[model samples]
Target: MRSKVGLVDLVTRYIIRQKGKKIRPLLVLLSSKLAGGINERSYRGAVLVELLHTATLIHDDVVDNADKRRGLWSINKVFKNKVAVLMGDYLLSRGLMIAVDGKDFDFLGVITNAVKRMSEGELLQIQKTRKLDIDEETYFKVISDKTASLIETCCTIGAMASTQNPELIEALRKYGHSLGMSFQIRDDILDYEGTSSITGKPVGGDIREKKITLPLIYSLNKVSKKEIDSIKKLIKSKNDSVAVKEIISFVKKQNGIEYAYNISRKFAEDAKNALTVFTDSQTKLALESLVDFVTERKN
Candidate 1:
């Protein structure tokens, strides 16, 4: 992130100071270690994935007009949308340059594909938000592209860095797919029930954004048509605080949270099962532990 520009340096400092969970890079490192051992390519792959993740998050903040990220002011809140958008582009360009300099075409292909999927997923989600009529399949499609693709890329790049064995690479990819699904499902659950102190972000941001998630989807199917319409109206209303509170209560009463937890757990199990390709080792254990952590994380 080094640059002659003073604002670029300043924004770089601001972003690094309060890094989030950093789960993507960790997956990269761990997968590389599990497959063989960490090398220079492993580090490069980690840096590229993290750059893409951060850039997307920065762009997302601008799109959402977000005030905070993690527990602090978002890039848009501090630097305004203009600077934030440019900063995201800067990070992306830096990542591309890094891959080009290293001649890591595999990394470049995976990252470019991820970028495409992320853009499509975000646009689809926006469309669904406007209509507020997302189904379970559509919900999966959104998260699979927007969230899961990033995680899958981490594992993909990492596996490529360590080995050319197609079986091993495919195994890690499958593991990443399920892990990402459970991770986003758990995240959606937290938006409804997580504590502000724990998650940093205020609860019910999804409802405020008019986003329908798995929990609400399951509950909506169980209720009467009249009740469902009323709940939808509450969500669509401009009164965010009241809507958030009422919707949270409604989702909990309808057992949406419980249903979501069960589903996330199943995905977690699937993630673990995918790791059966590798022999038992500390690295394998760590990878499996990540599955539990993603499903059970408070934030």
Candidate 2:
């Protein structure tokens, strides 16, 4: 099969070579291995998942107007918004092409569904912005739709690429869903508690953007109505440098970070348990260790 060298080369050479965790791709590989043996199809599928993830990051940076990622300038920062947008689109299109090359219509359908979910998730966040009364139900709904869905997709594709067992596919999907939720919760906690140097962005970027992440939601639940009003006002204000500090302090005082960590740990445990159906293997152990890494990662 002839590769689309130009588009693939542009994305791999320019966009995807930067420091990325490649977590989704890793999931694909690991899940595939745990269920069955690795194969050429699994490797290609892993690459496709990573490409799709990169495409989303490019688009996310443009939409969020974010400057830094992975401790470096975001593509939107270095390439300008228009180029960044097109680069993202190109990468997404390339991912589709790669999926087709896998010759699995079912896998293609799974990936297309993830793309749809991610689009809807972003739209949901945009629709809810600055409406700071974000409840727990809505918060989980948003994260599951936006973040967990794709991670679940990664595991689903991985299983199909290897063993093609319906039960194992469902099990790994559950594993990834729980892991993804924990991952996002950890991200929300880090936003409140981590240094910019560690997190690869400002400590309060979510607060500055007025994005109601998990910790903020927990803190909002704990605080009085008056405190919620204060937080809403602070988020709406332009000069919020000091307010960011105050919000962080308030969240910690309310045990917002701790609450989020507890929830994250629960999900991590659930993810580890999802592997019980699979027999003992190095890949399974790696998957279990990934849970601890998710909860313990500083960045």
lDDT of 2 at 152: 91
Question: Alpha-carbon error at 114 in model 2, in Å?
Answer: 0.8
Off by over 4 Å in 1: none
> lDDT of all predictions, in order shown?
0.92, 0.85
TM agreement with the true structure for every prediction: 0.98, 0.94
Score candidate 1 by lDDT.
0.92
Q: Which consecutive 10 residues in model 2 have the weakest lDDT in total? A: 1-10
Instruction: Quote the lDDT for 265 in model 1.
Output: 99
Which ranges in model 2 have alpha carbons more than 4 Å from their true place?
Answer: 1-12
